[model samples]
Target chain A: MFLKLNEIGDKIAIAASGGKDSTVLAHIMKLLNERYLNRKIFFHWLLQRYDYGLDLFLLSIDEGISGYRDDSLETVKRNQLEYQLPLKILSYKDLYDWSMDDIVKEIGRKNNCTFCGVFRRQALDRGAVMLGVDQIVTGHNADDIAETVLMNILRGDIARLQRCTFIKTKSEETIPRSKPFKYTYEKEIVMYAYFKKLDYFSTECIYSPNAYRGHARVFLKDLEAIRPSTILDIIHSGEAFETSAESNPTNVTVPGVCNRCGYMSSRDLCKACLLLEGLNRGLPKLGIGNTEKLRKKHLDEKEKSIGEYSSSKRTPGNPFIQNFNDLKLGSDLKKPL
Target chain B: MKINLEFSGGLELLFDGLKQTSVVVEDSSLKNLFKKIESELITQNKELFLKDEKLRPGILVLINESDWELEGQYDYQLKDEDTIVLISTLHGG
Candidate 1:
């Protein structure tokens, strides 16, 4: 693989998840740089702080929960000390002041993984952008890609299925994303790590009750049980399949920026902004639920006022009543606006 | 009017309402069928449907192998044998 290092440039950032896959990826990149690329490929490690409370879960305590108290801190410290590479640690708290419990509860509400995935991807992109990197590399091995392809095909996710092929790079974005190990397998990565005796976290996240992936993994494993080459066959099939570019459509960009949070969205208010509004209104389901209730409430009040005015037949000379009606109309108009 | 509802990928789900269940589409579009299914699911498992915030993330609803979000809204047109697959996103890296 070091022979291929000449094709890659000097400025690269390896997305290290502190797991076997990413650890091996980082090591491989480093080896390529040192052995063949002449150690010129300047690399940085970006780690996301997913506050799973794994330490608490593992140790069964919640007394100390800050940065210093984090158990992963030692591992990160050791990595930084050994590798001498700059490591950026990003947390959800830094992005949004929500506890792990709060996030889990919120996600549990929809049973949707979109929130976390979007947030993490955005964080990684933003972090990479801040670090002034040209390209970002992730440890998305062949097995991961194959699994994703299978998952997409199963769910009939045409867009994802189409886009899942090859090295994806969004030039319009601040920093482009790539996967050197996109053609590599998870088992190969594990074997490489084991062969080299690399230090990495083996435990799964305490909260990852990943039912879907677990099912897919088991199915793949079962297939592999009958034929070990099935994994590579799936990867080869994925590689051979040509995704038509015209069929896949990107997200439609909105004209205006979000008033609350300046994230790019199709509407004037993004989902996060709407969520914040729900939080502010003390009704978390305000945006999620049937919005007709909120609209009807205003309409009902307006109808009541109109009925009262029509029945009372207020005199044009009555200044107090006129002012009161003006105030009422103003308040009613202000509700949705 | 009896249409097949199949999930393509290897998603092993123990659906409570859909037991060898084939639905009849009299005058409803595919979107309407999904609405019916959603309502049925809600009725069958109110606890799951009630948690809207957590449900939207990572869950992709596909009608006839196309993403509902990309195609039409939830009310997109439906053919007789169009399969609707609900896929939950993988969490681990």
Candidate 2:
């Protein structure tokens, strides 16, 4: 019901993960597209009917986790065939020159989810830009939003806590991303998929065994079991929270483009650029946690290794060439002098 | 008593990647049927399917294509050749 399809503009893409929620979202949108275009007279009385010939496509991001992403991509392909919607698959390797597998190898399993989570958010935006879609919709259900609200509160991340409950998020620079299933229940999504015999991939990431969100999810699900309304209750509570300016003094700053990749960033380098630099320099921890402190450490390490340019030189052994320059990603990092 | 059980949404992994199985139970109650399936059918990750002698919170139970919540959840009576589907909603979105 939160889809607000008419406001989503003509060209739209669903950020499908091939999970049950996204699969259900894709299927629903496809069905709606058919009805909205083919039977306009039936919905003529509705004030918010879709435009003529509504365009819908599925956009998927391949994080390149071995056993996880490859299998899921197959499901997305099948969905493409079933829904008769065009599909565009973009890989982390193509976008960032680092797969989740590569990130895990360099940084170990501890904080790789950070890399993936950050990379995927931007990957979806970039993919949307490439597709020239007006808006991107994700299958983030009420359960997901509620869990995220709990997580933000638990982590005391007031910034995100303030922003997590919105049904649609928009900024001037990027494509608007919205949640069509904002009020939908996770159980309902799975049931729809099951009853329809929709194909979906449903495996946990092998590297995300210890993700912090998993704990929040289990806790939320437990609460949901006890009271089915807990999911929406949490969301309502999050929206009702009037975080005072006394608690969170808003940081007012103009957003600028990353010097390295030209992505929108408040700082000179975006998070992805910083993370990529860490991976390339063999200092995988450089981009994670305490940015200023890590930048100091990275510069100190670069100073210590100045005599050896081998670290800066792209590894001949690693087959995926750093395509940062090719993609207008990392054209600005000067060689260690 | 006999029942058909189906697992999906990654619960199949706990059943050695098997999606469906038929098991014979000594009783006609859902609880007894789960106990039988737990002992006979489940090959790995029993905890994912059950916790503290109950179905895990994230898993949804359907009795003959209806929501188990509406059908008495884990206490529903099982008839001969009934189909019960257990789907795990815990996977990534």
Candidate 3:
């Protein structure tokens, strides 16, 4: 933990989601703060409203589990009351209004989970920045990291494999994000949670359709079953490799305030603005670029025209003569001298 | 230089998607190497690469242990024995 803390300074906020990993992370941060040198350590619990289609019954059920409909708000309130840490909870109701299908159609994402992940990241970053924290810590344990590594390999995403390793410090125009449990395994975190009896929600997100990651997790579990140290081996193997420092260039910082909603982004409009544009235009699939379908349609039209012309005229000369007559008879054509 | 590269989690799946195990390039710039790799991927699997006139988002590139987003984009220069890791952001909880 100390080694992990060395990477992040004293002023930090733990993103608590009321889940096992986050709860354990918050606890560990608190314990470390108490045992270590005297400094006013700040911990903020950040949570998002997990919208499940706004059914009153469902919302009531959610409220029953976490005193409030929003998990982040509840976690933050608890933190303030129990741990006495400066906490803030933010909520956005847009997710409930927009279905996973709606988001996917607008963003070209396959599932709701992808949309949620991106939205949550932006929300957390903005929230943390507003709170004025030096570093933002997440409960991304070893298992999650390992699972991510496996998934990235499967998807052939080279950039993600390189970037996912250590705690992510902010790039230019980005907030500094860190993961203290990057080295800590999921099992250890879970074990610690269970042993310490930390209060956390055991239920998975209702809309997590991560079949690919699920397969990776299962594959890793199978390998770990054969060799308990296999997880560590994978982690060490990831640590051993390095990416070419030159290959990754920072994104060109774009200058513009978002027209739809004011948010800092390099593009003239942020992703959210783009999504809204697509939605407003009723062209949810506009940006998805189903180029294959378009290509196929174009080929079909060309083939159909060719077939029509060839069938109508046995000699290619006849088609040319007909075209010449049509052009001559056209309104723009003048009489021949 | 023969560099042994390893990918974790979703990144390992890239090997399945790749036609070659290691990329051999005369140039040493990370940008050039990545361009070569992207070209190879496009040539082999045009359907995947040419989706939206660019490589799909959510995929990340890493040099050594740092994220390309953190280090630099494709412009990062490659040294002898440098390993590049490609991963996808597919993690969900």
Candidate 4:
């Protein structure tokens, strides 16, 4: 397992959330790099390959939550100073022009997690691309992964159920992200950090009640208390579930690029783009659940609004509709607004 | 006996945002201490810390900087000046 760090790469980004798991992960990786990686002699360089010392960077996403993320970012900054690693902090306001605080205000607390989860996933990828790192490592421990497996199964999300068990998730469109603490229990992480006197932030997000995952996590923890191996067993069960295409035809989705943001998606618009559009249009619930029906209603309203504008001089409110107008009326509206 | 109690991973929020507080209590198993905290120290959301008359499933208990699981869990007898840390893993990383 020690050799696995050597193989990951020269430049890696740690997705430090300023929490116990990620803080300890950063500390351990730095220790390994200094004590082991720096002293290793490279024999593969004889075959025309050059070797370099390990480079680590701290990447944090500021979801723009006031009390939660703001305080956590302070801890990340301290970690950068302490660990001597380059740190990059990205915010949703910068990436998507919407912060979690703004999202919660616009959409309320009910479905804000949907937006935060989708946006944060892409925000990390965007941050990794900006850093030009070889790989991104997160602080997802065994408990988190097992809870995700249970959630996917409960939601009947077969695609995510198959993918959630992976220690490393890589695809053509995304930066390869791995969980180094995949098998480590949360208790062990907290204990290690406490003993080491590592600095970390440990406050829940103000906007996240997150009842669904909380229930699943409680259930998993209860099972773990009884058997102690139930977490890994559930993960193994998730890994063992094999659904042939014939057996699960509806869940299969071909990966494609979103036309709006050019991110990977099964449809023309990715979840982030769709949610952003809904928020932009003053209809924050459009992308939450049963989007197809809401989307049809939106399109019908757009068509009626377009019919009212006969001059073709007026532009539509949605950029997507404006794109259509730009293509149809190529030279008409190009007369400088 | 006096024991140092450390609340973290958002459990401090329930304890008026106080991370470490030394509480005076009689020598007893760690199980009895749960009630002492819920009644005296914890200000709200007792369910987050204790559930089903036991330490909540997601809450981790450590005695003297070692996992409580290693020291007989709730059955372990408390010692004078022992550092007991209660960390809630329910928070997001």
Q: State which candidate has the highest DockQ.
A: 2
lDDT for model 2, please.
0.77
Candidate 1 regions off by >4 Å? A1-10, A37-70, A105-112, A239-337, B1-93
lDDT of 1 by residue, A305-329 (tens): 4334323543333111111112221
Which prediction has the highest lDDT against the true structure? 4
Q: Sort every candidate by TM-score, greatest first.
A: 2, 4, 1, 3
Q: What is the per-residue lDDT of model 4 for residues A133-214, given as tens digits with 9 covering 90 to 100?
A: 8789889998898999999999999877878888887476677888889889887888788778999998777888789988
- lDDT for A96 in candidate 1 is 39
- Which ranking of candidates, highest DockQ first? 2, 4, 1, 3
Runs with alpha carbons beyond 4 Å of true place in candidate 2: A1-9, A41-43, A47-53, A244-246, A249-251, A297-337
State which candidate, 1 or 4, has the greater lDDT.
Answer: 4
Which stretches of model 3 miss by more than 4 angstroms? A4-9, A38-76, A94-110, A244-266, A286-337, B1-93
| Pairs of colliding residues, candidate 2 | none
Instruction: For candidate 1, write residues B1-93 as lDDT tens digits.
Output: 665564211111324434235677776665566555556533354333224422332235556555566776555666666666654322333
Model 2 error, position B29 (Å): 1.3
Worst 10 residues of 3 chain A by lDDT: A51-60
Off by over 4 Å in 4: A1-8, A41-53, A249-252, A299-337
The DockQ-based CAPRI class assigned to model 3 is incorrect
True contacts kept of 4: 0.80
